[model samples]
Target: MDSSNWAEHLKQDFSKIRLRMLEKLEEFSILRLNPKHFYSIKVEQESSLSPLAELASINLESARMLHIKPYVVSQKSLHEIEKAIKKAKPNVTINSKDNELICSIPEPTAEIREEKIKSSKQVVEEARIALRTKRQDLLKKFKNWYPSENELHSNKNSLEKEISRYLSEIESEWTNKEKEFRQLK
Candidate 1:
């Protein structure tokens, strides 16, 4: 692959790490609610339809409430949105009022924050492992590109620096999210 392709692959790998964290979409944090988790929800009795992100606009109404206003504003769409949310997160309580669905997230207690912080650390560590694995795979590919042993070693070192840079980006994001969870609302 060319240098441009190499850069794109590295960028995509970083994004994959972020998307993996969104696998825990059932959690109350709106930041973790990536489109990947809600992209498949069929709405309005349609076999093929837009995803939840397109069907509605989500607003952080409050620390404990997320307001979702559908663009079409139909009863069937409302029910479908409600069903999608319920299917995605059964524990969250959703109320419909004035053509909007309000998802009631539980108050973030200290225990919950602590639990989330722990889990966030675990997820970051998993990302680190995944990154290392990706680096290994990339190294094998690089070996073919760099025939000389010394040249391959130099490229491997540069690759390690790039991997560390991506890991630091993930680390910074996790720390910020942890701080957000620890905030007093």
Candidate 2:
């Protein structure tokens, strides 16, 4: 497969494995250090079956990384597993070791999105300020000489257009940043 396709596949596989590992690990409060490389399962001494190794088998080469040794499975599963292991223990090796099982979880932050939103708000605020300033300058220039209604409306419209140019520039900058942020993820 191509690089991007392979990366997507790996991402999907890791996501599923991480979910399952997290759920199972929560039972024992056994924090998985590198779940992507190691999985920890608790088994009771009484149980003949190997609960840890069973899950480990699904992800090959993961055994070498299990370092947290002598983890106890729940008392109930231990009893059942002991009976099952009588028929299965020989098939499962008894080794306790934790290794690098780094879990790769992708977490996206809202900071970038928030920044874009703030920029948009800033653009509007700036436009309002510019328009207000222009109106003040116009009033000063007319200096008590009342502008006719048509002349006043036309002047205000023209000033608004000038204000909009700055607003458009701010909007374009925000858009470019947003696009760049999306690509980073």
Candidate 3:
């Protein structure tokens, strides 16, 4: 393959890596009490489970509070919702008040923040591993092309630079996310 084609392939691969990294970072963010967290809950399918979002209307009563009111009020469904929330373990306080569930998200303590940081680090490490795997795959592809020694060496240098650049990008994202997590009350 020509240098141009190789470069294009690398760009595409790098783009995919970045996209996947972004998705992982989003998951890390969802570890907190955001509306997106509601979407993460999947109800059981014995015809007895339904997603919380679908069963009720969730509203942000305040910056640290959420109010969920089910459209069809039933004790069983409410209990199921409560059970689901507890099972998800979002570290929030759940209260059933006036036929609605009030979820209070507490400020993150030092220990909680530390846990989040550790989780974020794990996610970043996974991305780094993925990047390394992609780099190895690219190297193998280049080797199969039977390029000249000089060309191979030059491509290797370029590939290493790309890998370093991506690694740094992932690190930067983790650093920023860590800061945000720390700043969370």
Candidate 4:
């Protein structure tokens, strides 16, 4: 590997780290009533169980309400959706009205919000660890290429800067998510 390639290489790695961080952040359910969460359930079809998201359109009717309307509205489909949602989220209130299932998500308790905040902090800590690991990998690789103490120290400083920047980014993301979680009703 050429010495000049470090910048580009680390840039790509940081991008991947950032992407993974964002993906993990999306799993913070307390932050919002994400429609994607409902898609994870499987509803019974004619012969087999299929992804509910594939058969129906999940719309966020409000912050705490979800309207799941199947493409082909029928008693069978409606029952299947209600069953699936109940199975996955027992606390959710399912009401069949018109041609859609109106799901009312229960409000999270104070303890639940605290638990989610703790988990979010853990995720941020994990991302920081991952960044440190990447920094170490770069330092090991630079060992074979760097010729003098000056170049070695220069690269270490660069890695530290990247780490600091990413840590800040992770913290900021978590802080914003925490605010959202606190606002949940």
Candidate 5:
């Protein structure tokens, strides 16, 4: 109702937007395979899902190689881990030897690279839609909170500016990821 309360409300809304943006970025990150990406993979367990990292120890053997050894050594557990990796469909060759699984991440082909870029663009667009929805919700809240037309107009301008800044930041993040994906070998 007051100026201070409105400012605080705006701050909370901005923080929520930033948090959602970060979550979207994290989701995008998992779509690509890096040394750390393996950790994001989840395996089905009875009635729950568990992260691959929790079930297995993934060691980076080289820049393009990973050695995964499950802590609970069993035929079924190993098979489940292997199945999870295959389901992820990462550009990697999986070989089971002894009790460990060796993952060989090869350089992306031209077609593969193109596909990844396209997928990244789709993800960026989805993030933009989410951000736009959040902006609209904020505008609705502003309308309900601010009764004066002049004050509402001023707040709308500032909110639009903030939204533009966040959208640019999201674009920059996607660009950096695209560059990284392109440079992979």
Candidate 6:
């Protein structure tokens, strides 16, 4: 089952055999192959004879047709063959953005939020109170360092600065979004 000698041994018209193989092959996996899919692959006998190969060979009137090659898949080389099969198959998406996790991850829902409650309601309520007390303590500490008017103006200025910073980030994000949208079309 030497693959190298197959071209000489294959006496049938390549075009006619290919046409019949495409039309008569019942298996989705085999029928999906086009001549483009056969490129660079060498045909060899599959363990002397398999029923599918025998049928394919008979339909094509060539024993050499039974000598179809496997893609020589190994753990290391399987990805390449899988990629080629995916390309040959219809409606297959390999690492496509439309179905990717990054694009399709659902927004966290109320059910997910409720699952985070592991403690008693009283304990959670106390914890919330404690956190509020700590925040108030920090605010009081800041107040001691500045007059109330100065602190109020300082907070407003800080908020304006933060808003400007966020606006810049959003502008850059929108620009990238537009470019991505255009490329998709």
Q: Score every model by TM-score.
A: 0.66, 0.27, 0.73, 0.90, 0.66, 0.26
For model 2, residues 69-171, the per-residue Cα lDDT tens digits are: 2234344543443333334323233332242122222333467445544554454455445445544655454333435777556555654564466446545
Among all candidates shown, the one with the greatest lDDT: 4
* Model 2 worst lDDT window (10 residues): 25-34
What do the candidate models score in CA lDDT, each in turn?
0.73, 0.39, 0.75, 0.82, 0.75, 0.33
Which portions of model 4 show Cα errors greater than 4 Å?
none
lDDT of 2 at 179: 56
Task: List pairs with backbone clashes in candidate 6.
Answer: none
Better of 5 and 6 by lDDT: 5
Candidate 2 off by > 4 Å: 1-146
Q: Answer with 1 or 2, whichever has the higher lDDT.
A: 1
Model 6 TM-score relative to the real fold: 0.26
Worst-scoring 10-residue span by lDDT in model 4: 25-34
Model 1: C-alpha RMSD to truth? Answer: 4.5
lDDT of 1 by residue, 1-185 (tens): 55336657877887987788645423535323333444455554576656788888877666666778998889888998898789877656889999998877666567777777787678778888988888888888886787888878887888888898988887887777777667736
Q: By lDDT, is 2 or 4 better?
A: 4
Runs in model 6 with CA error above 4 Å?
1-147
Ranking by TM-score: 4, 3, 5, 1, 2, 6
Worst 10 residues of 5 by lDDT: 25-34
Compared with the true structure, the alpha-carbon lDDT of candidate 3 equals 0.75
- Reference-based TM-score, model 2: 0.27
For model 6, how big is the CA root-mean-square deviation? 26.8
User: What's every prediction's RMSD, in angstroms?
Assistant: 4.5, 21.3, 3.6, 1.9, 4.4, 26.8
Name the Cα RMSD for model 3: 3.6
TM-score of 4: 0.90
